[model samples]
Target: MSTYAIGDIQGCYEPFRRLLDKIHFDPVKDTLWIAGDLVNRGPGSLEVMRFLFSIRDSVIAVLGNHDLHLLGVAYANRKPGKQDTLTDILLADDREELLTWLRHLKIMHSDAKLGYAMTHAGIPPQWSLTEAAGYARELEAALRSDQFPVFLKDMYGNQPDCWHESLSGTDRLRIITNYFTRMRFCRADGTLDLITKDSANEAPEGFIPWFAHPHRKTVNDQILFGHWAALEGKTDTPQVYALDTGCVWGGQLTAMRLEDKQIFSCGCDDV
Candidate 1:
């Protein structure tokens, strides 16, 4: 039984299916860990969700920013933007079942057996694997609770600057969620810098890509993530994998077999 980790599909269902076919993934035996962003910004959000649900028993996925946004949109009655391909998901006949599945996904997974910690965004410098997992669990509980919609309505912000045990309510949860879901670049002191999404060279004076920080706390655990598509699949360490190579933007969709380190990829079609 092999374990395969796939990068963000972002609603690109054809490439997703083709990549699985290329890898010959067996739902009955093999397991798949998705690096999230499973739906949004591409042509087949609903198709991807449905297909993934069909194989849910064998999949482990951490929720990404887009995935959270999908929930936010759903709870808040927000309409899809022009660039978003969320219409299919919002109009799906089995939308409740899909949303329920999405809500239960975690933000971090550290499989001692696999020797890796999987998240959509890298773990922050301030958090150990244990701490990160705890934070993720806390937010997961809140998101799945009846208070979820209230939390979602107030969840879009970047205050409290850094992780602090003292911060409470939605502010505390949002901080942790952003670090594990939306973070890309950060200040050297480890504060989330949410504004810039540009080439690495163009990062404003104090910002550096989150994983490139000198004092990363989860370094001892192999951290595998996506979400920073502009990085184009690069990490300073072989232990850390950045597999989102903009597959939804006509790049390659990739999967790596965790047991044998075997790699599989499929060329994406133009959306």
Candidate 2:
């Protein structure tokens, strides 16, 4: 038996499957931990969702920004932009089941025994792994409860771009969601630089990559994360894994065997 951590699929199902084949994945024995962005911007989101749902018990995934966008659009009637390609999923016969399952997916996942943790994006500098887990549960509780629709409506924003113990209501959930899904660069005090999406070298004058913050609380744990394809899986940090290799942008789909950290990839060829 083996475990593999996969990068953002972004709906590039063919390359995702090919990467799995490259790794010779066997559902019966090999489990998967996905860094999220399983849908949108590619041609096969519906297929990806269906397949993942089929093997739900063998897979663990955090929700990516795109994944949340899909939910917002689906349940909260949030409008879609031009680049959005989630119509197939929205129109699928199993859309309800798929979206429901997606809504319940975690924003952070960890295994002490495996000595690794996973999130769609990096944790905030202010949060230790323990705090991250608690925040994730709070967001998940709101998402899984009857108030989910209201939460989804409030979930879209870049407000309160910093963390504080005093944050409450939608403000708290929004900040928590941003840290787990949309974050990349931030200040030492955990203030997110939401407007900057460039590579680490180009981070704003007073900002640094979240994982590079001097006082980041998760330094002792290995972190697996996606959502910053601009890095192309490079952080120059041994314990930090940036798995989004831009498969939907014609890059490659990547997977790493957990036990040995060996990588497997398949070209997307822009779908």
Candidate 3:
């Protein structure tokens, strides 16, 4: 019995499956915690989604930006771009089933037993693990609720700058979604800066990576995330693992065995 925490699949179904086979993952005895990006930007988005959908009960995933974008694009009646791989999914015979199952994924998963909090992107500096979980529930409820379309309708942007208690409507939804899905760098006071998506050297004058915030209280809990592919699978700390690895952008797909933190990765030959 094992629990495997995999990095962003990003629609790379072959690598995703090979990595699972390498670990000999058993749905009944072993569980999975995915960092998300289950679809988009890779060749097999539809197959990857269908495969995961078949085992939703055995898998736990935190929705990534690409995952949410797939939902929004589907609902908003948008078209997939040249680099987008979601057309395979949107045009699938079971598109409705796939999208519905995806919407059911939460944005965060934290286990005190495992001593880790897993999210698609890093959690905000202002949030403790407990608070992050609670806030995740708030958005998860909305995402799972009938009002989800309304929330998703206005879910994007960096407004409501800091966490404002009185934030309302789409503004509130955007703030919560951005923090959980798009957050990377923020100021010491915890205001998110979503515009700059670059390396540590270009972090502007005051912004810092979410993990580097001086007052962050989650240092005790290992934070596992999978955005910022430029990190090249480096979290810069043993306790923190950044697993994006650019699998969708022509890099290796990585997975970690949680009990002993043993890494299993497969190289990518095609983009």
Alpha-carbon lDDT of model 1? 0.85
Range of the 10 consecutive residues with the lowest summed lDDT in candidate 2: 262-271
Alpha-carbon RMSD to native, per candidate? 1.6, 1.1, 1.9
Candidate 2 stretches with Cα past 4 Å from truth are: none
Q: Each prediction's TM-score against the native? A: 0.95, 0.98, 0.94
What shift in Å separates residue 201 of candidate 3 from its native position after superposition? 3.5
What does candidate 2 score on TM? 0.98
Better of 1 and 3 by TM-score: 1
Model 1: lowest-lDDT 10 consecutive positions: 197-206
Ranking, TM-score, top scorer first: 2, 1, 3
lDDT for 164 (candidate 1): 80
Tens digits of per-residue lDDT for model 3 on 44-83? 8898888888888889999998898888788865455678
Scored by TM-score, the top model is 2
Error of 1 at 75 (Å): 1.1
The clash number for model 3 is 0
